[model samples]
Target chain A: MRFRYQMWTVFLAVACWGLGSVAQAAELTVSAAISLKEAFGEIAAQFEKGRPGDKINFNFAASGELSQQIERGAPVDVFASAALKQMNDLDKKGLLLAGTNQPFARNRLVVVVPKGEAKVTSFEQLSKVGRLTIGNPRTVPAGQYASEALTRAGIYNTLLASQKIVFSENVRQALAYVEDGNVDAGIVYATDARTSQKVSVGFPVPANYSEPVVYPIAVVKDSKQPDLARAFVTFVLSAQGQEILQSKGFLGANQ
Target chain B: MTDPWFSLRLSLAVATLATLVVGVLGTAAGYFLAKSRFWGKDFLDALFTLPLVLPPTVVGFYLLGLLGKRGWFGQVLFAWTGWEILFTFQAAVIAATVMAMPLMVKTARAAIESVDPAYERAAYTLGKGRWRTFFQVTLPLAWKGIAAGLVLSFARALGEFGATLMVAGNIPGKTQTMPLAIYQTTQTGEDTTALALVAILTVTSLAVLVATNRLAQGRPW
Candidate 1:
């Protein structure tokens, strides 16, 4: 009888410890696009300030890489993609929480050259450069826009045939090529181009280039913290969140 | 549809070039480390072996800084020639060489040191000079181990991804080696092509390992 009493007390003590940790704050993980790193970091800090006990972790990478991780069942609660295609694919796969998808932001594509460089002033001049870097069109949304823009401008084949084009894994890498002066010019998102001090926009691609760059976000279906995930998504779609994204050079969905 | 063998040929070229360079340089470093006793030898040994435990991306990051236009040596070269070498096949070769060098040096050093000291003493008694004795005696016995290290370095160079990606920038038909192609193809949802490339790499790596092991062990039969 005495031994049973001691065992019951120990079990209660263990249960109390687990409950105490839970009260300290549950962790919420959000996987976002590499381009969204700065914007989302600010948003997460704001979100965390409201819920003192909540801790948010972010995994940032290329949209394709992040989507592939989600497809492989990474323990992600929220996914915000820089492009609609990745979110759309996962939504079609029935892997996203129903009705939680929201179009939060958009971005424009631009061509950039290294600081103090005047060799190429416009997009049409891209064909003349020896090396013009852009993200890989197969997966990067910004690259798709650039490729389509060049095609519409009637210079895609010219650049390809001339071997004046190079590919980067993502938008920032494209910007880096121009920033480092390794390439004569590069095409990347206007937002990404702004992050570098050593590169400036040479020109903005026309709106007729490709599909509009839309950023869609949603909660993953298998989230362990569904309420928290939905709440975080709600916070991002809020007016203040849109304001922060705009400050970072992103556009409102309506724009 | 884009020549499927393009990436494979490029990979072989990079690996072969990297192996040849590392073979000569690494062997020399290994011989010195094994044969000499100097101050700070442990520190020097640690520096050479450090890459083995570091992530390839970290090595690539350092190499990028070292070879970029504003880098240490790069600033000098660019100031003189108004050009930088990043995003070229040469950059890819450099990355692979930096990454694969440690393994070759470590293995070769151990093998050279394992050569019996008694044989060297006997050669000295016969009035053979140090250089001739080393060339005739030390090198012959250590050849198999050096061969094994070279093969291993070649295989490691073939799969180099992160550093190559950082410095070389994945351009198809230009800087894209087999492993880079496999990763890019996989990301683009071309799983079949990626898997095919992976299979080719697997077979080539296995053949390299088997052939080298047989030769190194003197059991060719």
Candidate 2:
């Protein structure tokens, strides 16, 4: 009985090993910016449906952080960043293939206040508020954009004099401050504001007020699935992907 | 040597100050818990170190809620005087103090317990008051152990992550500490800066560990 049981176990192990080897799936790791999380989750599901035998893994964080990981020799296959600075840094380091980086979408910077608050109406009124929440411009791209826009409007120093400025770690957090009414108002991406019902846009910062808001996508050169990465990039550029982005309030590449 | 570099120095400074405050408070609490017994003493002992076991993000969240303007304590403070602790370097210190408290407390407690109470009693018989006994006799004898605890707490404070991130929110030169700086570098794809910060932390951690080991070993004689 013992001999028979041992043989049965061995046979089962061999069969499982054989099956595992034959049907093993390829894993694709993609690191993306925090803003792309909701959109990318939908894209990953679609990508999986088309490529049945592959699994997609994702790591989402601030674009700056994602780029730093790639630079530190992280094994990310695809990188989707909210800004071009980090991508260009990787490109300069030869970590990314030249010409593979493409601008995919654009976002707008807007001033937001609590949903029911009647204190502020126009961007100019933001100056009258006692507090304005923003992300730390040095580390967060959205904050940098807000600072640039405020600078261009030439109200940056004026706003500084009248209001307390709360610096958050990311634009989403700044949005949260506004949503929760923790600050009189906050500066965040328009798409980020869409996720919360507790905040409303006071006004869009004019395009000329700040540097262009563009999101770039690129395939890391060290990717194990270079072909798949390229395919994924193409999919993002396709009309279908553009539709997904546009539906979520992001401007498509052509826009 | 740039903005990040300046941020790095500021972070180190904050962590150092945080370590000092936590060390003093934790050592006093640890000594009391280890050497004396009173009502609810055990519970109080555990409370001082609870932050160690609790999730840092949770600590940060509650801390934010507590320090925010609408929170009870903050509201009272604001009502009494126009003062705000949230989103400031002072808040960073509070987070670091809470996060590193357990290390110092646990370490100091162990050292205090390891010293035989008979020695303390002998000093008491030599006409020392409880406070004097502790400061003059018990403290000197246990100084090495306390030093070890201090170093351990300092190292723990230097690497504080989630709580600092949550409460301090990574404001460069204001709330950013070493771990936050490293995290920011990695996020931004500034590999050189990240790598440099990592090396610096590694060396500092090793030096602290060495000092901790020597202190823990007690006097050779």
Candidate 3:
């Protein structure tokens, strides 16, 4: 009987502890583009430090994939996307909180090659490369941008015809392929290129090569904690947040 | 970054829960198929075996279409409960269960069929009902094979990657299993972390398979 009483007390204590934590912290699920991983990690840490009991969870993927998840009723509180098109589509579908859409950062597309490999230095010379990788244009914003740039360089069709193009699930995967020396060259964000030491930027895709890469953030309409979600959005657009992003090789929204 | 043990714990929980669900449903389906002879039984067997042969991504796509909020039954569920099933821990279990069911059913069906029906008939003649005969006679004879199937189902559930990723959306410390963590770490160029996770999964799976082989050989140890 004494052992049974002890076991009951322990069970009750464990149950209460579980309930206590759930009651204390407000968890915000932010689904963001893969490119925002490092910057957003820093910002979330700082944001949670200021609001002691609040927790932030991130779901990082391609912007298009994130949008599709939101559309399919994913329980996302906030979304930070790498491209305007994805955000615009979510807005048109009434999935975003009204007036919460704001562009917080910008980035440039660049061509990267394995370190110490300099066979192709210019965009026009990409045709001579053995294997070129980019994110899948269907679901990755970086891939769409890379495709537009390749089209402008007049080698997109030739690369396709010659089977030199390898599509990756996301920009990071494209970067990984190049870093692993599996591909001769890859097109990815300048910010992503900065994250790896095994790859070096061959050249930045010209500004006129594709539409500007702007990152927009917003709160989801189905968020249970709309105020907390809006606060996170505000924090991401703050000067401190912009500083973090810029330090990671991203351009300020105004730029 | 997620705590290294978080994915391991989550994968164990998801796999265990999925195995429990698959054990019950698959065993029932297997027994029914073994005992009953009906029209189009071959088609039914083929249907049950489809998921085992179909690419996991294709199965994931079909699950998404059937369970997404805009989907047929999902729309009704959302309208009544305002709850979405996608991207949750429950979604991981559902994905694992679907992927692991075929293994359990096939193994259980073969095991039950291999059992001598004479024992069941003797139990019936001794005044035992069908359920009692099954529990007392047939089950004792077939438990070994059924147990092997359960272990196989658990291993399959633990390693499920593509379907779970599609449905559960890879949120670290929430829905990211070990396989998803390895994929994410590899993409992020964290080769050491990926290698560690890969080693853990390979060792665990190999141990499970060895245990399964021992069980199949009728060794209790």
Candidate 4:
């Protein structure tokens, strides 16, 4: 019994130690799209190394989901979405600081398939594609772009009717469907496609077929760390930031 | 207002259906375990109660794998019927049922075990058949416990999130049940809508708990 008590006491001490570190960290909560996980991790490392006084806290999910959280009063310091609509909507609600909302980077919509299986080079080819996985358009910006591109290609209704849709909650999950070889193809942001070595991006959908893909960043109106948020935003739009984005296959905002 | 109402209706519908299926199956299984001796009875009991200890995500992921068109059983069914169950209302029902089954079974097994076996023996000696003895004597004595189990199942089914999302895919007006709605609203900063729905769920869950407690106390018995 004494041994068991000692074991439990040690276990409790370890658990409390784990939580204490998390509670004590100087966290800056930045809500971002799921696609930004890899990029943000690298950026956070550099940002922390330079600042040395803070850590970046990321709340990553579909842009729609993150936008809702901000509007509903989540204590997020920064909002970086894969699309402008959600950020713009938040701005319209006066939830973002003026002059804070700006396009920082861009990404393209791409058709992705399992590596070395088949190739798709044109938008029109999507109509004949089998097992197309897409994020739910109602909540994911990448899915909306895919919808617009498919509609412009005049294959939206055909693809819808084929009823082969596999809806993931976010672009990352949609990308997983393609990477895991579960679906023959998936529509995901070019940034998301770049994350996986198991899948190869087939081709970019023509820009004319859909609205320009842009990532927008904003400081929350009630941010406790607006300066830090702005710094992160500026870093994203800076030449160095653009280089990082470009290296990850993301388009520069200036383009 | 309209969105919350729709979400609430969907939640109730899903929960009710799930409770009905799980309550029946769980009670039957529980009764069998409590009273009958069978091969691997202990193992079967453990298997049935596994979901109680298992994480919801684990259950949800397995459901996703099993219900996807390319999955082992799903592929066969899809080929036979040209149908896909994943990301559909049917899949939501399945997820809720799986998540709620353990609660129903656990509650029901305790209730069944609490009954005096002397009652069953008495009925049998009076020449009552096994089925008749169970229906007339055992069931009536255990009605309160069964009702409590049903309510618990309903409450569990209503709060289901992870499994439902994994299986149903959150298609609005199709598979976006209440929990998914709340998640969507919260994710997008629709605080008013999210809080309102949460209030509704809280009230409903409280009512279920109170009602179950009253029944368990044999208030109406």
Candidate 5:
């Protein structure tokens, strides 16, 4: 009836509003790791406020996943990965603009347990007591770092043989497993662990605990706005961007 | 090629197993509802119809709560067998089955209801037993509808994503299905593989749907 037509009209109006695009000087498409969501979001806001004409669009996901998107020609201007291996591979493939791929930030890996857990306080105790959730080492750099650290601690194979470990698609999921109380513990970046209130860090691995977790940023060779890409990368390495990242529990790439 | 094929094989395997389960259970449940008038029938109908309306993620999240290791049923099973079902192929089948069952049930119930009660009364007067009358007379008349519903159910099962991901955890070479593979690849901007997987899924579902339509039409082909 008349009411139904009005409802349809309202729905179409909302849909059109959603589909409308904003006019801007330039849109800088940046692909960053999911673990960098908070830091990058804040930095993007700061950048936007400073230059109202330029807009920043971020595609956040796992570093490996982001790199693969960049590899296959996603419309991304800047690529930032949580792990160096993906950036190194992209650079080797000549996908990055020369001299633009630089380490912007670093992260530390930590083991977290469900909030208010009673057992398994220390890193070594994890092998004896709780199911451990880890990212797949084959695809996730955080997983590799975790496995290496466990190997150094001499418990990787033991946990494997005991079938005490499960794997997730990414670091955030590992944290989720712990947060949901589905797994006894999870290995994730310190920044990821911090994002979840339902989980708490049980222990932080040493800085040189395993492979270094340096985040590398680069301008894509296919970038249409190479100058804009360079500017964004420079901003990420700038004192302001570094301060924002540090405030979000990330370490500087150098220190 | 083989890499994507693994996901395709897993998707087909999961959908086939799920369709088989829902096909039998849905048809049986549909027939029961059509023939019987019992307490809480309206409530049961609403419950069975819910999956069709709710978001897949909501269904998936509920499945996790019910079947996860710490869940009531899973906790008991874990205590008895030291086995948990989450993050495995079985969980994927379960997710697909849960998602596809509602469509089958709804379609099947309507099909069975459309059959005349006079045929059952006639079979009974001819000394045919209940089960025999149902199987011989009522079922044969209504089977095309059920088959169509089952095929549609299979199509839904193949596209299942959120619930499957919630329970099965998308472990490659294990629980990863074509839909999840497409999602993973597309997320990473691996479009060639993703597009290939998308085409495979589309063609298979479309073929099944066309066949369903043909069967429904009683076409000679």
Candidate 6:
């Protein structure tokens, strides 16, 4: 009986410790789009090295989903979205700190196929493919961009009506589907295609085919560490940050 | 990119806590359901079993509605304590507990029910109180099934993903269990990391299931 009580005491102590650790230091929670995974990982490391005793925790997901989380009161310090639409919606709701929204980087939509498979080469040829995957337009900006590009090519409705389109949760998942050969082709960000050696870019959707893909970053209005969050944003927009983004196939913000 | 082992450690901690909670609550509920006969008992049983049959995403959606900041209970909690439960480690444990409850309840109920009632009758005749009779007589005989149920529940909790993701949000080193890690790694094109996580989860689940089978066969070592 004594041993059992001791075990429970230890358990409770550990649980309290876990909860307590979360409150220590200046932990900055950054909710960014899934496509920013590689670039932000490096950027966060650089930013953290410059500022000791501060940790940056990333929550990567669809920008729309992240915006929804912010609206519903997620404890986020910074929000970096893959598209302006999600940021604009949150800004309209007054969820962002005023004057904090800034365009950080840009990317283009590209069609990719399994490394050696090249039957479908262009947006118009997407309809002839057995299966085509893209992020779900409702929640993933890449999907919305891809949908617009396809609409410009006059194949979006045809692909939809023919039931040849598979909607993924995010751009990375769409890229994974193409890489895994589960789909003949997928429309994803150019940066996403570069991450996987198993998938090759088929063609870049013309910039005018859809709205220019601009990435935005801002501090959440309810951020506990607004200074730290703003600093992280500035670091991401710095020359060093732009270099990392460009190395990963992203266009500059002013492009 | 925190410690690679963070998700594994978090998952173990969450599963252990969730199983401990389920062990106590599920066993009591199981014992009560087994020994009692009441009006609307079938409805109650169905209610307890619903989580097992419903899709995990549906269960997660319901949790989000109940525990989200704007939710009824969540609104009260936030107003009173200024503490938001969503995206926390506690939320992962709660999601695991809800997901593992049905398994524990069903298995424990069957175990307790299978025990002959004559043993309880003898304990009562000897002037033993109900609580003592249950702990001394009923529990000893039903422990094997209950133990098996606990093992299965632990495994279920370890793999709980959908609900945890919905309520806990995939905060690495915090709420990212092995399953969530696997999903995230795969999506991020980190096949090597995903493969490793998948293998670890598969082996752990296999060991747990094998132990459960042994316990259920009445030959636990």
lDDT of 5 at B55: 91
Off by over 4 Å in 5: A1-18, A21-25, A119-121, B1-221
Over the full model, what C-alpha lDDT does candidate 2 score relative to the true structure? 0.73
Instruction: Report clashes for each candidate as comma-separated counts.
Output: 0, 6, 0, 11, 1, 0
- Cα lDDT tens digits, model 6, A118-145, are 7566766777999999989886778888
Residues B103-145 of candidate 4 have per-residue lDDT tens digits of 8888888888898999999999999998899899988888778
Q: Which ten residues in a row are the worst by lDDT in model 5 chain A?
A: A15-24
Pick the DockQ winner. 6
lDDT tens readout by residue for model 5, B103-158: 99988899899999999899999999999998999888888888788778878988
Candidate 3: tens digits of C-alpha lDDT, residues A209-235: 998889999999989999999999889
lDDT of 4 at A219: 94
For A1-255, candidate 4 gives per-residue lDDT tens digits of: 354355336434533442232122345777777566556656767777878788776655567656665664545788889889989999999999898998888888889999997888776676677889887878777788888888888877887888977888777678768878899899887776766778997887877788999889889997878888888888778777777778877888878
Candidate 6 regions with alpha-carbon error over 4 angstroms: A1-26, B37-43, B68-70, B78-82, B208-221
DockQ winner between candidates 3 and 4:
3
Model 6: per-residue lDDT, tens digit, B1-221? 73446676677778878988999999999998998999998898898898899988678777777777777777788899998887788888999999999999999999999999999999999999989998999888898889889888988998998778777777777667788888778777888988888888788668656755665555624
Report the TM-score measured on chain A for model 5. 0.89
Model 3: which docking level applies?
Answer: acceptable
TM-score of chain A of each: 0.87, 0.87, 0.85, 0.88, 0.89, 0.87
- The best candidate by TM-score is 3
Classify candidate 4 by CAPRI docking class.
incorrect
List candidate 2 stretches off by more than 4 Å. A1-25, B1-221
Task: Report the lDDT tens digits of candidate 1 across residue range A1-255.
Answer: 354345335434533432332122246768777567668878988998998888776655567756655664545789999888899999999989999988989898888889998856665677788799988899678888888888988899899888889999777667767878999899888787776788888888777677888899999996889999998988888897888899999989777
lDDT of 5 by residue, A51-100 (tens): 76887766555676566556544446899888899899999999899898
DockQ for each model: 0.02, 0.02, 0.25, 0.03, 0.02, 0.28
